[model samples]
Target: MNIGVIIIIVISLISIAGFSRPELIYKYQFNAWQIKNRKEYIRWISHGFFHADWVHLAINMFVLWSFSKAVIYYFMRSLPGNSSIVFLVFFFSAIVASSTFSYFKEKNNYNYNAIGASGAVSAVVFASILYDPFRIIYLYFIPIPGIVLGIGYLVYSRIMSKRNVDNIGHDAHFWGAVYGFVFPILLNPSLLGHFFNELLAIF
Candidate 1:
């Protein structure tokens, strides 16, 4: 079983559990106040395993499923035997990295809470984008290059994060995407040149 499928199954099961038990979501969902004051630090990683609703869960899992294979393929090519370990670390670390900004921003706001795998999912997506910049990604039924969509996503997330106009964790999405794109380059700096070469090929 591939790591991505395992992740989907695990997250789906936990999310289903949260569906049946609202209190589970309340306890595990990202709450900066709990982490900061109560020291419930596990929420940093735990929140990514559950979600707000079926739709939310479906969307995240779907995106993860779609992008994970490509990311894993690239990882395997780059790191060989240690690729799975590296991929697992990348995924989980992205969850924590994505939430770090929110933890600091909302530490004092007890009412602020978020639940979903979107942060980690965003990481997977942007990682795939790094590998295949010119690949087509259908956004709301419109076809666009992966690189274009990635840039647009970052811009939108940044704007919305600043606006703070909705319940969506735009900050998480922004940071997760950034971490996803950077983590691979950090692992193997040569990948940065490969990314640029891929872009140059299309232009």
Candidate 2:
């Protein structure tokens, strides 16, 4: 199985197991205060494995699978022999990078908690968008260009993060998407110009 599919399977199994064992869920779930107070730093990476429920897990795994193919293709073309390793780095880094803002923001909030693969999935999706900017994407059953959806996603996440009413981690989505979009370019700077050329080609 490809790394993306492997990840989905691994996460699904772990999440299902965690769901049945509340103690496992509590042990791995992201609690910013726990990291700040007890030095339980593993939560930064571990939280990505557990999720709120099946629907959350399904959505995240589906999105990660959907975009990972393209992102992996681009990585292979861009990074040659080290594609798989580099892609894995990107995926794992995004998980950590996506949570930094929240960790700092809620580090003192004893009640704050988060879970799910949304951040890492967002990273995969936005990274795919960077490679195929003009591809069509459905947003709420409405088709929009990939680049347009990327911008809209970031905007919505930013606005929602400030509102902070929903249980969803808009901050993670925002930061993960940003990390996904940028990490590849940092790995292979040539992609930056390629992205612009692809965008300009659309006009």
Candidate 3:
């Protein structure tokens, strides 16, 4: 794993501990991580690791692992404008960005707390989509592939978010996915050999 992913895993473990240890977690750890205000938004950056349950951790980390290869592989290639570090900056930044976006918009909701690596994980998955929209990716037991399902989920999240369904942060997930899909194209439109040559030439 890259530094970005390793750091995220470590944070996720710590967040899990904090979430499970209410008294100790709060006392020893910074309270800002629980989705606080501008003064505490720094916590939002690290808050993606904390999960509501074991199931959440398993799913998020599993997806992270599954998709990390494509993202990291794409990022490791050479290109103009520092393509070497493309995925790291985009992945980690998107997580923090997504958290901040989620909190920044819903701060007034009072009950709008956030957690999980879905924001970053979604970025990885959506990045895959941008790379190859027709690629197949199974969701749990389903085998519909990611493009169809990913687009479907994006729309679903937006609709459900508009409806304000339950406690879901659909906006964060959607926007995170959007960032994942966009950053790659914007940074390196070539996306491969020809794209790389043309992009590098511009720089």
Tens digits of lDDT, candidate 1, 104-199: 999999999998889889999999988889889998889999999999999999999999898999999999999999999987899999999998
Q: Considering every candidate listed, which one attains the maximal lDDT?
A: 1
**Candidate 2 lDDT by residue in tens digits, 1-203:** 77888888999999999888989889888899999999999999999999888899998998888888788888998865677788888888888999999999999998999998899899998898888888888777899999998998999999999999999999999999999989988878988899999988857
Every model's TM-score? 0.97, 0.97, 0.78
Which residue pairs overlap in candidate 2's backbone?
none
Off by over 4 Å in 3: 1-5, 23-38, 78-85, 192-203
Candidate 3 residue-wise lDDT, 136-200, digit = tens: 78877777756688879899988987898586668778888888877777767666454335434
- How far in Å is the alpha carbon of 104 misplaced in model 2? 0.8
Q: Which ten residues in a row have the lowest lDDT in candidate 1?
A: 78-87
Query: What is residue 75's positional error in candidate 2, in angstroms?
Result: 0.3
lDDT agreement with native, every candidate: 0.92, 0.90, 0.67
Q: After superposing candidate 1, which stretches have Cα over 4 Å from the reference?
A: none
